[model samples]
Target: TDLAAWAHQDVPFDRLVEALNPERSASRHPLFQVMLTVGQSLGSGPELGHLTTEFVVPELRIAKFDLTFGFEEHRTEDGGAAGFDICVEYATDLYDA
Candidate 1:
């Protein structure tokens, strides 16, 4: 696929969007309705001497696309795959919660 072949290319996203020149709309993204991202997990917060710490996720107040899915792979102490933290964001104007 052209996308796969060009994955390593250093093209800026705005440039690509400009080149495609899809119909402009205030209610939708220019080229895609959905997006997916996979990345390393956000590790636990720093350790305090003999005190406990918790990882807190802030609230999502905005949606960048119609739908966006994010997967973060967590790793064990010994570098093994632990689990995944998954999250989905959707435009409330377009879809019901």
Candidate 2:
């Protein structure tokens, strides 16, 4: 599917778990938040994804997503690249439904 289609799809929970690493659970990485803003924007039902607020050390070296929020870059005080560095596994809620 295309990027647009992919963005509107629901990602499975198992897939998200598999993407994270087993170690580094105690690291002090910044938290990443992925909200179902689009769905709510279109006056849909409750938030699609049931998010579990916790640290996730990803082991997968996947390419950056083409989403506006997920793929944008950030500059930190330490002169290091900073951005959404964790996996966002959630089901999509289409506004056109």
Candidate 3:
């Protein structure tokens, strides 16, 4: 029921944050300090009607949150499970190696 409720409600994240009005901080996210995302990887570029497309990963070092974990599943040629690519993004100022 919670998932259905969430699906019916289309609220922007910033608007939700503003409505909630969690404690503001210059060093962390307003509502959450960490986040996680899991999805399938984009293996190849898609073809448009008459244009070519590609997926380009930008070289970004900025962290919007204190920590974020991303998991992407890659498939093989025959649609078999190839492997998983895991990445952890953290704020350098908040964490040290």
Off by over 4 Å in 1: 3-8, 42-60
Which portions of model 3 show Cα errors greater than 4 Å? 48-52
TM-score against native, each model? 0.75, 0.20, 0.82
Tens digit per residue, CA lDDT, model 2, 1-97: 6997589468675565566543444322222323322211112244548853543347454322222233334456665755533334432331121
lDDT for each candidate structure? 0.88, 0.39, 0.87
Q: Which run of 10 residues does model 3 get worst, by summed lDDT?
A: 5-14
RMSD of 1: 3.5
- Among all windows of ten consecutive residues in candidate 1, which has the lowest summed lDDT? 4-13
Per residue, candidate 1 scores C-alpha lDDT tens digits across 1-97 of 8888488378888888888789998878888999999999768767999998877768868998999999999999999999998999999999998
Residue 44 error, candidate 1, Å:
5.0
Best by lDDT: 1
Clashing pairs in 1: none
For model 3, name the residue pairs that clash: none
Model 3 Cα lDDT, one tens digit per residue, 1-97:
9998689589887888878889887867788889999999897689887888888878588887899998999998899999999989999988995
